[model samples]
Target: MQVDSKAIDKFLVELLTEVGTRLREDSIKKMSVATKKNRNDLVTNFDKKTEQFINGEIKQAYPDATIVSEEGYGDLVKDMSGLVFFVDPIDGTMNFVKRGDNFASMIAAYIDGEPLNGAIIDVMDNEIYHGGKEIGLFINDRKIDNPKNLPLVEGLVDVSAPMALANKFAVQDVIKKSSGFRVYGSAGIIFGHLLTGKEVMYMSYLAPWDLAAGRVMCEAAGMSVVSIDDAPINMLESQVVIVGTQKVVSEALKTLKTR
Candidate 1:
């Protein structure tokens, strides 16, 4: 189905808003938290419930679409063919478990690897960034303009804390070239900032669920989202990616030390 139209946008916004409501209410309740991948990688009861909720909703609405999701409640699809959905129930789980804030819920649809529409909810703020290359982007209902093509020196960059500290990919070099550096711990929030010109560039290792919705919104806003190693982005794999203005992306690619 064509998802960039007003009707489709409304459907998506309502869906995301419902998810946001659940999150807002769950934030106050005591959550069951657990570790995933490592001690620091946390997942909570709300995360699983939210993912199950989203997956069920998607199945009911678009039964044929294959879902790739952060939580395990999705299909184990190996390819991005036909209609596909990528979902991150809670984009910043650590922050959600710790601060009860600075997190988001993201969902995006793609048709044979090309973005159809993406929806990202800044849950606490009640703002949803939703749209695509054809329809542009909307913060709730406000249509936003493209960001400036800022030079690396004129803007601040957001990098993962570990990458910055370890100087992985020569990230610290790129950080020193920019106005400064930041770490938001959530790709969805960082992508929102990029669209609003709050930050210039964001670099992090991201899974498909983490990158999908943000990629759609960023590209719609005329910002560049590219792989740090100068490879074509594969939606089925995890990789270090960069999203920013064209100028900043170019500088970051040049500064990136890849063997």
Candidate 2:
């Protein structure tokens, strides 16, 4: 069964907006604590519930679509040849648990191993970034323009601070050359930066759920998303993420020693 990109995009935007609003309402009702998967890793009840809710909806809408999601609400997706949905109930679990403002809900639909449509909802801000192959991207109901070409030293950049501490892939040098660096900890919000051209680039270590929606949306907006080495992203594996304008991406690649 072929999936319609427009239908998928609309469904994801609605689902993300609905669930993200619920998360905010849930937070206002009480102060929720998070459980630790490790020292810095965290999860909350809302995260699990949100994924389950979205997953249930996907099952009803597209029963054959494989789900690869965070928080264990999805199946183990080993193959990427068919239709699949990548869901991240909460992209910044720690930020949601600690700061409660930087997290987001994200979804991406893939057909025949290609990204078809995606949505990223900034739960705290009530902003939705929705895009698909057939139609362009929209923030809320307004269409967004493609970012102008900018040099690495002239635009903002978002990167994970932890990666700098560990010098993972030597991105520190890239940070030094950039105008400035920001770390928001959520792929969805960082994706927002990419959409607006607020940050020319967003780099970090990420999982399938983390980059799924952002990948499709970024590409739709005439941006590029790839690993440090400029390889095709592996949807089933963990990898370094770099999304930016073309120039920023080209310059950032200079600092990637891993390639």
Candidate 3:
């Protein structure tokens, strides 16, 4: 069967919108939360429900497609060789549970290890960052202009709080080269900033669901998305993500430690 990427994108847009609305309503009704594997790793009822909703929709849209999601509502797929919807029902679960902001619902569609489409819903603010191979990116229905091809010293960089401070992977060197660094817990939000060119680069210890959507979108926009080692990220695993303009990426990679 021919993959209808457009139809899938449309379905995901509507689905994420509905999920965001429901999450907001749930938040207003009551304050409910749960802890995941650790205290920092939080999960709300809304998270599970939203994942369920999105998972069911994706199954309906492409029954053969495998889903690897943040919540328990997906499979333990070992590869991305076929159609797959990598989902993060709540990208910033800690924020959602504590601050009630900075959270997002993210989805990435990949076929045969190639990214087809991606959508990240800024649930708190109701903005959708959407993109695909054929259609470019949009911030809530408005097409975003292309970001500048900035070098390392000329632009903002998005980094995780831990990665930034631990000076892990010689990240301190990147900070010294860049104008500054900003840490947003949610990968989806960082992705939004990257696509808009508000920052020169974004890096983190990203999981499959965390990196999937942003990887494809940034690549489609003539930007770069790769691991700290300047290698393509594996969709089935977690790794260090580095995204930026071509030049900035080149500079940052030079500072990164390859394992």
Candidate 4:
């Protein structure tokens, strides 16, 4: 059965718009914060509440669809066989808890293990980057052109802070090949820059929700989405996600191997 792309996109836009507005409004007040894996890795009340709200909405709309969310509200999805919605209600929870900016809400829908549609809402900027297999990438209802295929040496690359700090996967070498490096602390926002051509490439160790939605948008915009080792991404697990033009990906991989 072919899913209705237009209908899915419309529903997602409405859902994400509401999520973004609520998150922005909530940021002004004090939030309850707690740690998950470690002290530096934090989660706020809004993250749990937002994920619950989104999960409820997804269930109401499509009960059969399985949700794999960052928060504990989703199911333990073993595979991406049927309808699966990956949700990152707050991609940058630390940023939301501290800076209250540079965070984003991302959701991607996959059917039969294939990306069907994806949406990333830049809450601070009131901009939405969304697209699917049927409809191309769009920002706030306007169709945007594909980003230029700039080389690694010509443009800035966004790297995860931890990756750069630890020199993981010889990312520092790849950074030197670029004009410079940027650490946004949020995969969704970094992906936004990659889609708009503000950053030529982005590489990080990311979870499924972190890269799921952005993967759809990046591929739709004529960009490359692959592992740092030059392999296809596994949508159900964490991996080193690298997104950029072909030239940049090739160059970055070569640099990592040589290092």
Candidate 5:
């Protein structure tokens, strides 16, 4: 089937903006919450509610598109085939629940397993980082260029707490080679930073929804999104991933390759 990049980009931006507004409204209210894997891994009424909304809208707008989403509202996708959409109603659920900020809503579209476009709405920041291979990159309404292909020593790296603390993937070695270390606990927001050149690198374990929008946006902006283990990028599974400028990725991959 023929895919329309312009149509998809327009739909993604419009839908995410509508969803972001709802997320902002929900942020201030008291919502029921429950634990998943651990106490810190949470699911809220808003999370499921928002995901259902997005999935429903996607189905209505593009009936043939299969959705992969957090909160169990999506299809049971077995492979990255056909027209697919990935949705994270709240990318930083912990941040959204505990702090009422720092979270985001994300969606990305892929056609026959190739990225088409992605959009992330930082609910608090009110900025939507969007676009992909076909549309270029945009933050809300403004078009932007790629970040500098900076070396690892010149910029700070965002490391997940568990990865940094446990020295997972020998990430400490990667951090040491960089200018410094930081962690924001949110992949979408961190990816936004990477797109704008606020940071040079981000390393962490991310599920499909968490990785989808960021991966599309960052890669489209000329940044590198890769798996250090050299596995093919799979959209249906969780894995350790890295996103950064091309040069920084080369530098980081050298250290990660040792693991």
Candidate 6:
């Protein structure tokens, strides 16, 4: 089935905006939280509710779309075959529960294993970063400038906290080579920075929902999206995501090789 990019973009914006509004409203109230895989990995009432709302809306809007979501509110997708929607209702659940500012709501629509539309809403910041292969990258109404091809040493880089702490995949060495390092808990926010060239590179182990939206946005904006080892990213599985300008990617690969 051919996708109407315009309609999908509009629907994405509306869906994300609604989710963001509810997130803001919920932030002021107390939340019910529980541990997922570990104590650090959390799930809140907001996350579950937001996901259920988004999934329900998607089903109503596009009945045939398969939704792959966090919190298990979506389908048991076995392959990236049809129209698949990857959703993370709250990208930074920890931040949403503890700080309520850095979290984001993200969704990406893919057709036949290729990303067609993507949107990430920084709920508290009132920023909506969205775009795809057909529609160009945009922050709300404005189309964003393509990120510069800056090398690692010349620009700031963002890494996952665990990767930085353990120095996994030579992450620490890459940071030392870069101008500096930043650790944002949300991959969506980190990808937002990369989309606008605020940071030269972002490296982390990410799930499908975590990377799906950002991958589309980054690729649409002429940035690189690949594994830390410079391999093709598997959209349906967790992997080490390395996204940035070409130069930054090259520098990062060099640093990783040296370690």
> In model 2, where do residues sit more than 4 Å from their true spots?
32-43
lDDT of candidate 5 vs native? 0.86
TM-score of 1: 0.93
Q: What local lDDT does model 3 show for residue 85?
A: 89
Off by over 4 Å in 5: 31-43, 257-259
Lowest lDDT 10-residue stretch of candidate 1 = 33-42
Write the residue-wise lDDT of candidate 2 on 169-226 in tens digits: 7888888888988888888999988888889999888999999999998887888888
lDDT of 4 by residue, 80-108 (tens): 88899999999987887778799999999
Between candidates 5 and 6, which one is better according to TM-score?
5
lDDT of 3 by residue, 19-93 (tens): 889877765544543444443333456677788988998898788899999878998898777798899988877
Residues 23-118, candidate 5: write the lDDT tens digits.
Answer: 877765444434433333334667888899999999999999899998898999998889999999888777886777778889999889888889
Candidate 6's C-alpha runs over 4 A off are: 31-43, 257-259
Predicted candidate 6 versus true structure: per-residue lDDT over 65-122, tens digit per residue: 9999988999999998889999999898878777878889999999999879999999
Candidate 1, residues 1-259, lDDT tens digits: the string is: 4444455567678899999998988876534434434323334567888999999998988888899998799999898888898989999887877777889999998888897788999888889999888777889989988888899999989998888899998889899999998888989988889989989999999999999999988888888889987888999999999999999999888888987
* C-alpha root-mean-square deviation, candidate 6: 3.0
Q: How well does model 3 score by local distance difference test? A: 0.82
Report how far residue 98 has shifted in candidate 1, in Å. Answer: 1.1
Q: Is candidate 2 or candidate 6 better by lDDT?
A: 6
TM-score of each: 0.93, 0.92, 0.92, 0.93, 0.93, 0.93
Clashing pairs in 3: none
State in Å the error of residue 189, model 1. Answer: 0.7
Model 4: how far residue 206 lies from native, Å: 0.5
